[model samples]
Target: MEADLPHLVAFMLGTGVRIGEALAVHWHEVDLEAGTVEITHTIARVRGEGLIRKVTKSRAGERLLHLPNWALAVLRARHAAGILNDPVFADTRGGYRDPSNTRRALRTALSPVGNTARRDLGLSLRTLRRETGMTRKQVANHLNWPQNRVELVETGRIKVDHELVRTLVATYNVDLEQFHGLLAQIHDAVQPAESDKLAWIRSHALRKTTATALDQAGHTARQIADQLGQAKVSITQDIYMGRQSANPAAAQALEHAFDDPDLL
Candidate 1:
């Protein structure tokens, strides 16, 4: 990352702002004099329509954020030459940047040698289901899961976990080669970008880092949660503050006990 890209990434890391919120920011929303930014809008890609400016995900997401010195400096430099209604981060055509394309750019910049195997696993699944004449409800019934679960998985709203992947593979009756190919594509799509020693860093990782740093600096969970625009402090504590346990001994013990042929 260079030029405005580094500053953009740093701004997100510093402020814990989501990429969509940051991309939707306009000069009017930023007060360089006050070192603050109002986050009221977010850019999202609607299915039929193109990228549309929408309200923040929740009321909490519409709160104001105090800019750190670095972020303030960035805004100050931009404000010197920016128009009132222009986006803080503009596209080549001087319009709002698409968050999805921004993510692709980040991936490409961090990894020059792009992964050729990358595929739209979610779209592929959706196409497969449609080709098989299966509605979301029918697929959910086959998988013994909620219809919303099928919808979310197909729409990429929910991450496809191992059990879900296995279930889909079985339901689709994919051959070995197709199964491995689909698995590879899903793995690439779901795994974070790991290039240039960034260590799987994504926009959300920066937000989590901000929350963790705040917690380490003796800030209360409620304060961190507020800064992160979370509805509850427990979410900040459990997910972003690194307070969740990661012990895998239970899984290992279960596998050992159940996988033994003698026990069976």
Candidate 2:
């Protein structure tokens, strides 16, 4: 991503706040000297209201976050360059950035060829959901999905088809071919742009990275939860925390199971 998006990504990476929350951040909410930013609002597009600055998604999403030095440097540079009272990451016109469009730009930057990778597909679906102003949890509850399944689908780990998209969008039986045609058009429209090496990175990935870093640094699950504005530590542990890649100890335990003398 170009221009201010890199700074925005860095801010999100440091703070672990949701994309909407990051978009809604105003200069007034930031305490540069204190190295903290209050999370009070989030930007979302309402059907008739256009872009509205609303309260945080959850009460716990309103916690204050301490900025790392690098994030603070980003804020300082922005503060020096930007007008006061505007959003910390305002659009070119100095208004809130639409999450849908931002996500599309991100996808295009990552895969400028418009190949429509599984991650892009997930992001496209995510854009659709954001357009409808529905949270992942709400969608999961509506579809009777397991708690983490929505997140997994949107992360592109699970294969998705247009049928699933139609179902999730809550549309009546219609022409699936037409939907495919429209999706193709959307893919064609994403213009490629310059991006950093973390082209595959999305905001949620940054949050998970931050959480895993905190865990490695000896922070408790609750501490990470607080930093991430998650109400439940269990959710933090289950969703944000990354699993160890090489479980050598577990492997040894498994091998030991075969060492039992008594054969059943």
Q: What 10-residue stretch in candidate 2 is worst by lDDT? A: 245-254
List, residue by residue over 86-132, the lDDT tens digit for candidate 1.
Answer: 78888867888889788756644444322332236667788777878
Candidate 2 per-residue lDDT, tens place, 1-264, comes to: 354576877678767778889999988889999777888899999999999999976766777776766677778987887545468888877888998778655554443322346556667667767877778998898889866556755665444555566677662233445667547733443334232244667767777877776666666666667677776667657577653212222212222322332311
- Residue 61, candidate 2: Cα error in Å is 0.8
lDDT, model 2:
0.66
C-alpha lDDT (0 to 100) for residue 60 of candidate 1: 64
Q: How accurate is candidate 1 locally (lDDT)?
A: 0.65
lDDT values, one for every candidate = 0.65, 0.66
Counted clashes in each candidate structure:
0, 0
In Å, residue 15's CA in model 2 sits off its true spot by 0.5
Candidate 2 segments whose C-alpha is farther than 4 A from its true place = 1-3, 83-85, 112-199, 235-264
